[model samples]
Target: MTCFPVVCEVESVMLEMQDPKTGVKSQPQRLVITTIPHAITGEDIVAWLTNCYSIEAEEAWALGTMLVAFGYIYPLQDHKRLVIKPDASLYRFQTPYFWPAQQWPVEDTDYAIYLAKRNIRKKGTLELYEQVQYNSLHKWMNHKWDFIVMQAKEQYRAGKERKKPDRVVFDCQERAYWVVHRPPPGTVSAMDYGLERMVDPNTEELLFSCLFSLFSSLVKYSVTYNKHDPFLAPCLPSNPWVTDDVTYWLLNMANVEIPTKMRVERWTFSFGELLSDPRGRDDFRLFLKKEFSGENLAFWEACEDLKWGTAATMNDKAQQVYKTFLTRGAPRWINIDGKTMEVTVKGLKHPHRYVLDAAQTHIFMLMKKDSFGRYLKSPVFKDTQKRAILTTVENAQSKMGIIILKRRPSISPIIVRQLEQEERARMATSGPVDITQVMSKLSNKGKEVPPSKK
Candidate 1:
């Protein structure tokens, strides 16, 4: 079951990242970042993490996503440290492609040998996850219990003091994580481009991240650990996603099955497409004959374990022409996020995240951020919620207090009319009449005074 606390935590972390605060304990967030050409550019993700994590963008690489990507991948992790592969007893990979030992290294065969040796040395077996900080076992269950204790303390204190919590919690037992950018309070929908809208919190990370803003006010957080336990709190039926802990909350996603026969034939592409152009071809038959119009090994070799459902159509002029030209030349096309583009790898939903190196299987990596999760320029700015707060310092243009006119001032037309009537009554009678008023009965005081004899 997907933990609501975990989902909320991930969402909160996302919120904290947009506007970070310092000097106080707020919340910690785990970001799940994904992109094309995964290893080539960590700039966008790194810059983001450094901003929120309050570390130098360069230093941000020391933690979380980047850490996992660089240190935990097969060959590097395998070579640097002797470790056993996670076994079948506790938590197991559904497919051979996902096995820890198989996908972790740059050099596959050597790493596998190393893993085997380590496992045999440790327990007369080749299991790796048993010796790590977070093994392939039910570590998250214990972690979940610990979280409940902490949350219970916080929840009880919150109830007593009527305190608004600055943090939330959650766990992602399922593989997919979310980027929930909650809008400011009461904003349940996307309007005025507000970033803090509350999302379904139950969507694929792709769907969630697309809808949520890259900037926002609220905090979203996630706990990404691989463990499921029976001790979790009973999840409410109305929200099967787990506002609390839910071990039974089941979600079927990322099943990791191989590609179907039709998908294999239709959705794949070859390197020939990347090397060719379509405009010169006069005839379809001629187009097939011109080049080495066979399956290109360079491109096909890049796609190792990816599998997808179906093929998508090409739309743009360049894409359409390239699509036809490449298809004739032994290439195929695939759709990603609704855009059909030619790919070197065929039959996958997101091939951009896959590198040519077959050993690096984990694609999602997020930037790092600070306790409050702001991605500000200076680490000092992490202390404040709003940017204008920085102005309160010496030589700063910011005014500390918001100048509000005392509630409702006496400046309304209705109030002005009342004051004018009161003034006229106090003045009593007018001494003379002007041309505008002609002759006023109250003004002719000299002729009046029939008097009251008391």
Candidate 2:
């Protein structure tokens, strides 16, 4: 089966603290976590978010903006009252991003909504706890988050089993924070990247030291982003780098940190680096002027386009410059067939020949699941992992428990890995249209998928 890893960026930082607490300045720490099946997705997560956040339209907007301003992404939520345990992290991350909480399988969503509608008559549809179906589902739903507790009580008949009866206490009310607290505007601290700031010592003086270090760590023969190589990967804490094994491989990789003296002196990525900010960032745009003729016009243009945090793509020219520097000290035009998603590796070839350390990769996947939760859907993976994911999925699905393939497999993980280094000589390069969907198909090949053609 033809296959490769599903690599993409996932949101890492979350907004929790407000006002005096000032949530973490926020840094993107590289991590990996397990992908959960879709079974846990439901309204409990949604209800918790509503319970946690301010239901006021402006209140939610200010809250969401506070998060985005600190350099993490958050979405808008509509204002409504009567939310249940809103402090839940699942709801905090998913709600603003357009994930529908009510669509979740949890009946608590209906109950929560019922509680929110102040206009509903008390004895009508709004009368909660009386509905049979709602009560049943709510009871089951509540158990999902219920903590296991053991309690012991003393009995009058001493000496037998310590004369105590074990009892369990349900402290749901204490842990379930039903009330939402709305602080003033910019409730969360407008701090710098926390995780990086802790490590860098001078996160502000330097621009992207952590980022440069990470990219630098793996690139031995090359310099910057390789459009074909996974080295120049999408930025985020988890799956920052792409992988070939949809099961374990990843695309996680970036960060900010104290500017090294060298970075402070030479590579400071100031607001001026790509912006029109009066502090001088806008000057980077001078290359676009008719009179400017000192350096690379196209390269400089790319930098300017992304000055306001637009984001980076693998094949951009500046990254090409950096990658070119890393490889053979220069970039060269390689033969490429975009349609085929293939390219020839000359001296400047990049697709980072980097793979996570086995233990590190494993740890990273676990962490990724913590953030994206149920959105992730792969299993454990290794650089040596090479079952074409789909083949495994297909094998599991074969009605006879056996499926024949057009090609016999005989490559070692090591050999398969080395081949990944081969610069395909194709004049074109094209990846699967929908990498995630392709991954799902590969993982569930012949297995049972309600939506699958099988």
Candidate 3:
């Protein structure tokens, strides 16, 4: 799998932060319970980021929090909150082995082993989340519970031999890693790639209901789109491939002045389908104009252009979008919620292609929910539907005579050469042949054959 670019960049920054001479100063720091060696305060981390990148303190703090959240830097004291405190709270650069760029699979067996070791150390005093996971894993891996305990015991014994400071630091490092990976329930994990399930799979009833719902949705979708699917339904007029007619292609051109009845029918299938077709979007734009909310569609289209357009003009286009639609008192202002506005405005300060995503999504949902439904009911759609062209086989045949299905045959040169050689041999053999020559040829064939085995 391809690695995320941010992960690679974070790893590089981490390497610079680990430089002995130019890195954040570290020394033995006393925690509430113990003294951890080579620990740096959270203030030092934020300051180092600000000075190194020449950014504002807020941006530096955000970057530092990202580093901590991604498991590159782990807090030595407050392992629960993974953010730079901008104070004297102790933190440390995580060992490279535990960095997320390693792409290690956070497995249950490894977590079980760690929990078992912690159980032994704390004497059954693991935290609430850890305790819950331990019980679940125990039930799941009951067959190999004994083996897990044995491995955990061996690891704990080995850890006992390490120096006091080293052991404490390692313990804190491992704990921080797990806290990021298996965060308390209800909290979003930074390591999550958005594919995590929302419902528990172990509940049979819920799982069956989810499966049934998904199957129902599939059936409904197939039924709704059955006629629109070209492979499932015959193309109007005639299939271009089979009939060798270009009329179908001409009629279905993306920006055709007037779409066919079938194409207009497809627009009602979904909002996405309507927006995907140029003609449909034009019709939607017309409806939005009548409603005085055309800026929403304009902003959505600008965002799409920014996302897919050339990278060289990305920053300029982002600025243009902000000035045109997002800025207060702008000509074409779009309405979005305050929270989304804050996020979009803050992200625009360090603008990339997706800086306007939150606002764009908010507008897209607004249009989809409110404007899209109205557009279907509005006379604009009905007018377009009424004016849509209807082409039939008879009309096509009358306009452009019966399309002859031409079959063009292609022959390989090698086959032609082989046939030529066979013909030459046939011509040579067509004439009378000498019996002595035939005998000599048979003798040659016999000589060419290998001697028979004994």
Q: Which stretches of model 1 miss by more than 4 angstroms? A: 1-415, 423-431, 434-454
Best candidate according to TM-score? 3
lDDT of each: 0.28, 0.29, 0.84
Provide the lDDT at 379 for model 2: 28
Model 1 alpha-carbon miss at residue 187, Å: 42
Q: Candidate 3 has what TM-score?
A: 0.46
By TM-score rank, best first, the candidates go 3, 1, 2
Q: Between the candidate structures 1 and 2, which one is better when assessed by lDDT? A: 2
Q: What is the C-alpha RMSD of each candidate to the true structure, in Å?
A: 31.0, 33.7, 22.2
* Model 1 agreement with the true structure over 287-395: per-residue lDDT tens digits: 2233332222222322332222123321232233235323445354211221112222231222322322221111101111121122223233222222211111221
List the candidate numbers ranked by lDDT, top first: 3, 2, 1
Q: After best superposition, candidate 2 residue 268: deviation in angstroms?
A: 35
Candidate 1 weakest ten by summed lDDT: 171-180
Cα lDDT tens digits, model 2, 1-454, are 1111110011222334321243322222211232221111113333323355637544454444443333233312221221322232221222332211112232344333333321122334622323543345445544221110000111212223331111100111111111112112333333322222223344443446556676777684344223223355322222212321221122211122221121121212322222222212222223223233222333333333423333345345435544432234445221213311111122114322211112122333432333123112212111112221222223323422232333256679998776666645232254336689879988887676566585
